[model samples]
Target chain A: MKILITIQENNVAPRFDLTSEVLIADCRDRQIIGIPRTILMTRPSSEELCGLIIKENISRVVCGGIEESHLQYLVWKKIEVLDAIIGPYLESLEKAKEGTLKTGTILPGAKKIRSMK
Target chain B: MKPVSFATCNNFPVTEILNGVPHGVAILDRDLHVMEMNRFLEVLTGFANADARGVHADFILRSNIGNNEKLFRNVIETEEYLSISGDIISRHHKKIPVHFTVSPLKNESGDPAGLLVFIEDISALQCFDKKRHNMACLDKILGHSPKMQEMFELLPVLAHTDATVLITGETGTGKDMIAEAIHNASKRSRYPFIKVNCGALPESLLESELFGHVRGAFTGAVKDKPGLFRMAQDGTIFLTEIGDLPLTLQVKLLSVLDDMEFFPVGGGKKVRVNVRIIAATHRSLRVLVKKGEFREDLFYRLNVLRLHLPVLREREGDIRLLLDFFMREFSTGLHKSIKGYTPKALNILTAYAYPGNVRELRNIVEYAVNICQGAKIQKEGLPRYLFIPVEEKPPTSADERRDEYSEKAMPALDLPAEIGEKTVSGSWQDVEKEMIVEALKQTGGNRSRSAKILGWGRTTLWRKLNRHGLA
Candidate 1:
């Protein structure tokens, strides 16, 4: 199975339409197959991303704050969507792997701290 | 300073006080973890306080706060407050504009304990600003006069229908702008809006340009060309200067209006289109019909819905308003600090009849803004032709003075050495090119600043620059 997650830096992007980076992971039997592929788009466009999902044969999508029209389109294409989920992408990915990821899930955990350049 | 513990302070319900505040309030520990949040914060963020507690605030309130560790550390070290305006995404995926105030919280021994953050929703204020901006300029047509106000009210009513529209006005009175505004307000706005100028092209080319031509239709026709009517399918086709359309093309136009179909030049088959027709002219089509210059049936068909734009000179109380508007716009665009016009300058501007209407007024303001060095626009900054003799009192009635000048009853105006027209030479295009070149020279080839100096937007300047081979 293939899954796509929209991300900004390390955390899930707040809006799907404004996300310019996406991670695609190929999994089998609810376990990881290899390292996830990170794709960086030249610009943020939900329509282009939707087309990318179909072209890549993605079966599942995890994102934050997706509009209803896009959600319906993905559903129409037989792709499962877990949206309105916020937190670090790593934790979200883990939950998705474990089959515990739910819509509108706000993951709670310690945050990464780093100094400014 | 000794830190007073809130728990030690008896008879005070700190949580209640925090919850009673109007703004969203949240308490975060030094690790940038959400320790507690009030009811308002929960409602604003669309997350329950219980669920948000202990989670990183970045996840709960997804804002532009990059690297929370560094930001919180800076606030802790500096012991200073920071306020910023940004947007946050709620749990329901709704983006809300908000202002945030973050302050450091201290414990005993003057050690940093946590942070206190306040969030204020600003969407209502933003909505009000947007409403005010739309009120000032409706579809880029600015006028506060009662007649213009009535026309503004009628535009939407006309746009809702698919009736053929005819816009009549003098040159430079913004007839094209009215047609565009109607098209923009209509459902067909989602499609293309193709504009064709009947006067700009010759007769044979004009017909082919409107209805297109097939391969080998004319001697120069090399390929099949989809005409403007076909290109504007499911949209609007604006015919400007319709009075200039020749009698031959008028019959073809009338048939298209009646049947929504037309045959390409030399094409046997008729091409059907679903385009809306919007025709504009500066001359009276009725008068043209009587003169045998225009077809009466076509004129009547095109005039199903008529809109006549009043000249700027006749729009009462609008001259001063437009002058002030242009003055401020040019001042800001030119990066000048001009506040207003001097009384003498204002008198001359208001008394002069704007023969070229609003477009001319805008140009004059741009010219004045470029020359005026002081905060107020002085009389010397105005065009030389607008200046009456210093000894003569300014005219009290613009119409009467305009008529006197038209009848040649007024004395021949003395040509000043600094006459504005003398600075440029040749036809209107030549003068415009000279002005653009001069503006570019004045701004040292800075396109943005040159555009401001010429009272035009950057894209307009860019297109003109390319057209004149200056780019």
Candidate 2:
């Protein structure tokens, strides 16, 4: 399943620039796959989010953390929204590929990932 | 329920509640003496009724129940109900989580006569909470408070560009941590993080220390050495304790910031090093600039990127967190098994104002680890001064500070004596002659430049040279 990772800023790519999307994936096997993952701007309004949802055909919308407005927007768009999964993004992305990701991790333990998965 | 007289209610109601009421009750007089306790108190204590009246609260129930005397007294003073939850061990050593409240009594004149304390065991709820909230700390470097979440959000935005950062806070307040976080999250993470403490070395040595000096530069100059600027080429140079940089050095630093190229102290050849300078200072640099001690231009240059560290006291929320973190760190490093702090120690810590901030907290934890024997650290295990803050660097004595200032002023006032030392056992009159000759020899005998270098009036300089042996 393809996952859409919300990046804070586009300028952070290159050296330590790992995808924050994979951070929402599976922490056990964090992989980036180097595929062109859509880096959506953060906390967009409902209409803006809806436009991006249709544009990217984003099956799952994952990010570091989502505010209530953005979370609601994604939920309405029928795009699965996950936030709070932490770590280098590549690791989270790999978890998403494996389909074992628990949502809203923030760090590692705010909510129980193992129990949820 | 006919109202019983004070004397009968005291001894009997205490014993009666042990059997009748589900809650624990203890009655105290104007002096907090246990005039009467209910049957529930007896069950809670596993004791039979006796002459338990007229005993002090601490003596009647010494092991546990409400250990915080001040909290208890507050209830009495406020004439309001006060509730708190803590561990309570019975006579049989059975631990019960007690939620206790104290309510005061008023006389017929509507004045306080005594205090009444009620206790309810809350072990189950408190235990469940402990298990739920015991997860490992996630953002150890950034901290775990909502305040830190705000800082974490700023880190990425600050890293988006190459703006020079100026971090300000009290010493040991994680200014360096924020600087490191910026670099780590910035485009410059791959480059080196070179740090220099401006206050560590004397200003004379520091000039050469920061800007490389060529061989034969001064009396002790042995070989050419690269300064931090050359070493940190293309990386971030964190100028820590920057407010301490001397006035002379501030000018050089200002020029360096403006031109982005600084000549080595001794090297006739100019050297250029490309580096981003991030400065940090605990002192009020703005005040220093106003006093003309720090360069104003340099202050503006470094102020391009500003980050302030919040003191630990302001974040009373983080104390419990930092305490736990330091405890774990000390436990692992010392290989000890300290579980936590006793009620008294935690109270003492909560009351304390940690003057040294996080560094002081770390030191306290390590000190406790060395002496702690059991799982819990008691109040006595902490350093004596912790009971009272401002332990380090006691208040400066006014008279003593005046003497210290005069002691430093004494040397600068001895200009005649310094000139006399140049003659060294020669006639006092000829001493003036000898200084000019030495100055001339040192400066290739250029009188024009020597007159400018020395603060002597030009006419006075010539008169002195003639008056002495240096005709």
Candidate 3:
């Protein structure tokens, strides 16, 4: 099964000194290794994220922060969503690999962040 | 010193350290007035040094991290320091966890005043806490033997996987406990842990119990009953003693496990579920499959992640522990004040091979305690069979021939027997009396919960004392 983990945009490649974007540390138990897929920093709609999730053939999604409307949208889309995190981008990736991330909060703005100020 | 520029309004610029350099810095005074706010603070808070002047950190910082005014107060009141890690979503709704430390601030005279707060985004703490919490739940499970330990090690790894698990063990060997432990440790722990005992009820009942039933499906059709599978949607269900499941039900179970959906009994609508199956069996399902007692297809599906429980006899050292454990357990309920078991009795108990295992030993202990007189359980209190030697020389060939010719089960012991025996009967009291006497012989007159487990109320249990002429 392919699992997609979302970290802060700043964590991609040379921006952060991570050995790998997808955490393989705990993959032995899952008998699975994650495939790293990057989503640009611009705020995206839940439907848009769902499209991406489908494109990536994502069975599970892990991200640091998810807003309420988008969370509902993901719920409607039958896409699992989790928010609420404290850590560097890679830390969240490791936790996601271990299957221990918790329910994140509903972000102030739901699907749209342009007017979120 | 580097340009120590300050903004008069912001509270802490520590969050800037998480970035390339100190991007923001602010200082607060005794009345929580902004003493100094750096240029970095102005850019991040979206306030110029002039506009940010004299502003309180509370209004400027709107997040769980900024809400630690109480911890700040504690620092001021006790002249101590406090640090906490928590979540913070910025005005733009970019959520993250940060570490905050507050220390009592001193004036030019070194007198205590307000405080200096430092905030560093440490969302990593939340992730680490989560993993630690998961491990904590795993540690609650009992058992330390190699097999159990191996499974314990495997559980955390397995819990991460979305795989079907199979647990095998004897009755009351805590197979259900193992299933629960696994579920509790899994990613789906937040969801339900539904359980089904395949052997408890017959096929029709078991079917309805598993897949649910529509109202008016059968004779007891008073109301609609939701099946366990539906109840366990997006969760895990433990199917115990799966070998006892009828072949037809096995096929159905296999179908649902394969498809994640099933039709409710007598209901036209089909309910699709997202659930994991963790099955357990005491019987060798393989043997049953070969014997045509179990469905081969279903057996293979449920046997994926196999767990085996070792017999209690194999771990005899646990016997002494279990005995001491059950001793206190039975003593309280049986209301018998047993000081302890004699070494000789313990020897006899330890020497006997427990074919029935722990549960049987529990039954034996409960049975023996009732007949125990003093605080100590002596040899006389045990069943006579435990002490009898198997190799006794019987009468010659002619006598053995006559005994063999006898048709009764025990040949009625044509020769005189050693012990005194009498049969008694009477009123309801007599019936109770006879039953108690027999049970006492069965359990050795242990008038405790063990006796109650045998189905006699305590008072009726003691009636055996009077009837047996031992009172």
Candidate 4:
């Protein structure tokens, strides 16, 4: 499966339309197959991002908040969207590799702060 | 009298105080991570305090603060207040215009502890600015003619009330835009604005589309679907081409309008809804009713507030205004810096009667802008159909216009002796320049009233004046 995650620096971008970087990972059987490639976009545009996703033939997309229109368009194109997931992109990628990432998962506070508390 | 210190006021509920400020407030730690945020900020960003704590400020705000963290970090280092206006992506992924005030937070030792951020939503102010001036535009709709000016004055009055609006106009006369302007200015602006074309879908499908369907309602109905009325909720529903609405569905729509309730396709339960109806059509509903094809009661009900959009040609002096407007619009969109139209091209455009109205004019400008290579759009840049002699084209209902301002139409002008001699043999450009020079001379160099006399936009007249060296 080819998983694409919208990122801002090290974390998942808060909004898909405003993301300028994306991490594309190729995994198999819920495990990593190779080193993930990072793609940098010239601008943050939902239309261009949609075009890039289709051009790259991404199988699944993991990101934070996304508008309903773009989400539906991606889903209609047969690509799975795991949206509204917050925290670092690496952790999101790990979850995706393990096939455990779910939509609307807020990770940082849940795993780090809640555990300490 | 006692002066309270921060230590003395430590018992006060800081979170509650921050929430009561009426503006979004967030406290960030040294690394620009979210340490705490008030209820207003939480609601705006869609991140509860529990989940948002310890998250990076950029992720929490999702604003145009900076592409990276260096600019924000600099704000703390410089220890100066930074205020900027930009858009913030809300939790729903909607862009919200806002103003931000970022200030450094200091500790008891006067060392920087974190940052204090204040956000003020300004979308309402932006909306107000667009509708502020009593000029030739309302939102996106543009016109300068007396008839359009009358309609503009009446639009705001009609938008304030809940009366069903019936917009009648020729196709492409911006009836949909008028309908939208009403919805945008109305009290229900916050709700969805739904549109449905009565003639686009078959009667059976359209019925289900307008008034949803229950599970197993038909062969394709594996799941229940809430229709457009339900989707619109407390908003406005625009029914275009209302004349084509099936008579059976017309009765259902009338009942819905009367009682604010309707039954979904194959559903026994009645669905109650509150929605404003705005219907439009090019065809006359009265004619349809006379032919027994439309319900008279429904037609009258929809006609509570009628707004008729005049055809493009009927709106005197609007042709040149719209031409310049669309020319600049397409030029900017296509990344071209188009100066203006050539004299011959301008004459052909201003002379041609646009049967398709504003929409066709917009398409023509877009095509010309795309094909144009030089600073000015030439005759070849326009659609070839525009170059067809007026007599050769098929006559339209308004084709009686041939007698009014056919290709032979020319404003009576006292031509200069030299120009009068060339009237029979000179190029159209020479005659056009002479006509402009004479008009300016007749108006005593007053471009505003000169444009009116020539039935052209002020910008168009000014460009022609400059071209003729009469400015």
Candidate 5:
């Protein structure tokens, strides 16, 4: 399975629409298999990201906050998404690899999680 | 005393001071790591200060500037203030317009310490701008024809009054839009503008639907329900296809229009309302009255403020305008980069008679935008039905052949002698083209007057002009 996570520096982007960087990783048996590949965007656009997700055949996505319409579209496309996470990107990636990541998850030492829904 | 250390400076109540500010504020160290942020900033970005501390500023506040890092670096090195305005994606992933200023912060010893950022939400301003633009584009009827111009001028006057309006037009001639425009332009615009299609429901159900029903009014009535007429109090109630109303309901409608009071189904008490009535129908009320189907008294009541809407084929020069409008609308909505229609496609669209009128034109443009792959919509993008040539029917019986021969035997009616002189030795198509050209020249290129002189609709003239390559 291929997983895609929107990132900013070493942390999850605060908002999905503002993300300009993404990490794509290959996972098997609930474990990451290789070094994650990083893709940099020239500009931020939800439509462009949607197109990329379809083109890359990403099965799962991990990100911070995401809009309702984009989430609905991703759900309709049958792609699993864990969003509204506030934490370091590596910690979120590890949680996803372990199949323990969930929506609205705040990492250790982080402040209280605020629901966006 | 020695200069205050950076650790000592961090011990200050930075969060408290920053929180007191109206707008969002953030403090970042030289390494670009977020050291402190205000409560407003935390709520705006959906990131708690505890989680945001030590995180890169780039991760928390995504800037639209292409080289945001370089801009921050320049601000840190030069110690100069920079202000910029752009959009930021919030916790809900909604873009919020914002204005932010970045300035250098100094320590107690007067040495540069860190960068201070101030952000103000400008989403309300952006919303107001968008509303103004939409009001300009969507709140008016679009037409340049003389008949439509007259209606446009009269709409405001009619909207100012509370009289009942009767709008007559063919299907898809924009009667609904006209009614809505009148409502929007009226004093009751802030109130509800309810619409009910009279023809879509049966007589039995329509009564209960228009007028509220009391509990146990019928087999299925369990509770008292307010109707559309009540819902449109002090507003407007647009009754579409009013000609389809049955005789029994017609009497009830007449009473309501006369006294502005009606009793609910199975209710003894009468309910009064102050709703403006706007009735529209494609059928002729006079013919229905002649057939003993429509109430004559009700007809006269509705006929007090009559508005006759012209068919699409009669409204010259508006097809292209509507086409361009719908094309741009659909292209933006579908995220396509469709520039325009190809020459051949445009010619075909211009020549085809829109039996469904503007609504059909909008639907066709939407479909074309979806299927069009190139920058311009081509002939292949059009619906298959548009490309199919209409087959001509052959004469079936002896009477038809004789009638056809007689029709061809007679000289063209009302043809100018000059056109006859020029097309005497030409084929039928040539003669037809010459006659059209003569009519156009006589009318000084006024298509509407030329069409009237040629005894044809405006769209027919447009089609012929394209066919003869004279347009």
Candidate 6:
């Protein structure tokens, strides 16, 4: 399975539409197989990211607050989307691989990090 | 009424007073932590009083306000009331435009204690403002013709209703824009407005394009794809040149229109969609139906709400209005401050017949703007083609003269008498074929001229030619 997570400053980007960086990882048996690939976009666009998700054959997506339309589109594409998460990127990826990450999950020490601020 | 003193209301609970107010009110400490909040604030932020009691104001508001610390410090230092408008993301990720006001709150010893924050949702007001602006722009975009004015009045009513609309007009008459305007003004404005040109694609690809295909549906089908209909779910799909749709696909389209459900090409599952269909065609579907090229049943299904856009030549009164509109639009875009058109230039433009409609007019304006060096666009700024006079050459050969003569005589002659005199002993089909061949020959194989001579649309003439095996 492949998982894609929109990221910013080593954390999940607060707004999905504004995210310019992404982390794509390969996983098997609920574990990361190798180092995640980082994609740096020239410009942030939700449409472009959605295309990337489909072309990359990403089975799961983890991101912070995403618009309703985008979320519905991903769901229709048969991809598991855990959105509205406020957390560190590494911890969210680990949780996603463990099948424990859920929508709106605020990870431990997230408040102290204050990434968006 | 006399102004009440604060000391008179000192015994009343500040929280009670704040709760009675309509707007969302939150009192933040000097550290920017929530000290107290009204009922409206609790509901607006989706956080209860007890839960938000000690939380940071930023966490509860979740606004895009960047310099929060500086804003709070400035308000405290300045001790002046401040109001600003911005967007705030709600707990459900719904972005809401809000106006916020921060006022300094003082302690008993006259020292700054905290800040009183007022929040008002202005999303509705913002939407109204945007709608008013779009309506004003739409008026200018649609033109000031009487036909267009009628459309403007009917457009809103048509948009409010969820029904299939069939728009008929000549090419370049803004059929696509009408479809878009309807979609933009409809309830599904928030959703995607998908457009597909029915004539642009081939039969094989068009099926899969409108009704998606599963992976391995064909040789090149690498992955499953959702079609335009699915993408336009809960919105609108503007199918331009719908008359060009193949007969085989017309059956499937009819089924989808009737049931609001369709099976993708090579996909077993039925995809139920709630999409409004707005089909446009430059060709006459009624003529196509009479010629048996278009299905009559499908025509009836799509023509539930018909809108026929008038040709530009018919609405000559709007030429000047459209000219000025396009001038201003292109001038501002090109960063050129063109004053206006010269009298000669304007007269030439107004007199010319615009076969390409408003689109051609816009292109002309754009071209003129690009070439014009002076404040006003002169005849010199016009396209070179506009100045090239069409030369009417006389017939050079006996055959050409005879053909030209027949071309002029056909429209005046009685059709049955002409066909009867040409065909002595033959079926009606043979007589019809002879008449078509004669018209085609007289017009020098010009389909449009032959159609006009035969009192038929161009497509109807083409169908007749195909029937006679001449095309």
Cα lDDT listed for each candidate:
0.81, 0.62, 0.60, 0.80, 0.78, 0.79
Question: For every model in order, what is the number of clashing pairs?
Answer: 0, 21, 17, 0, 0, 0
lDDT of 5 at B211: 94
Q: Looking at candidate 5, what is the lDDT of residue B271? A: 99
lDDT of 1 by residue, B1-471 (tens): 122354233676565777889999988877777777889888888888777777767667766555555776678789998888888777665678899889998877678887888999899999887645533335568788898998999988888899999998766778888887787778787799899999999999998999999999989899999999999999999999998899999999999999999999999999999999999987778878998999999999999999999888788888899999999999999999999998767776776667567887898899999899889997657775554332334653333444554553432323333443443233446656877887888889999998876667999999999998999
- TM-score of chain A, every prediction, order shown: 0.92, 0.56, 0.54, 0.90, 0.91, 0.95
Candidate 4 CAPRI assessment class: incorrect
Candidate 6 lDDT tens digits, B1-471: 111132225688777898999988998877776777999887776666766665556656766555556787789999998888886665576777899999998876788877989999888899899886545435545567788889888888988999999998876788888888888888887798999999899999999999999999999999998999999999999999898999999999999999999999899899999999999997778878998989999999999999999877678478888888888888898899998999767866776656567777788889999888779997657764443323345433323433543353211211244332444225557656866887889889999988876667999989988989999
Q: Distance (Å) between predicted and true CA of B436, model 5?
A: 33
What DockQ do the predictions score, one after another? 0.29, 0.01, 0.02, 0.16, 0.14, 0.13
Clashing pairs in 4: none
TM-score (C-alpha, index-matched) for candidate 4:
0.51
Instruction: Locate the minimum summed-lDDT window of 10 residues in model 6 chain B.
Output: B409-418
| lDDT of candidate 4 over A7-46, digit per residue (tens) | 8767788789888999999889998787899999999988
lDDT of 2 by residue, B1-471 (tens): 112244445466435544576777787666565666777776775433353454445433433332335555667788888766654544343556678777887666687777777877677788666533321121345366676667667767876677788988766678877776666555566688788999999988998989978898988889997888888887778899998898889888888887778888778887887788888987777878887878888889889988887766677478788888888889888888889998757765655556466877788888877777779886557765443211133433323333433353211111134322432334434534555676677679777766654446778778877777465
**Residue-level lDDT tens digits of model 5 in A16-67:** 7777999999999988988999999888887898889989999989987688
- Of all native A–B interface contacts, model 2 reproduces a fraction of 0.00
Which lDDT tens digits does candidate 4 get at residues B355-416?
A: 67898789889998988878999764677555333233343333233243344432222234
> Which parts of model 1 have CA positions greater than 4 angstroms off?
A1-117, B1-57, B61-139, B387-471
* lDDT string, candidate 1, A1-117, tens digits: 898999877777767877899999998998989999999988888899999999999998999876667888999999999987867788988889888999988776323422112
- The model with the greater lDDT, 2 or 5, is 5
Poorest 10 consecutive residues by lDDT, candidate 5 chain B: B410-419
Model 4: per-residue Cα lDDT at residue B405: 32
What TM-score would each prediction reach against the true structure?
0.61, 0.43, 0.48, 0.51, 0.47, 0.54
Taking every candidate in turn, the Cα RMSD to the unseen true structure, in Å, is 11.7, 27.2, 18.5, 12.7, 13.9, 16.6
Worst lDDT window (10 residues) for model 3 chain A? A11-20
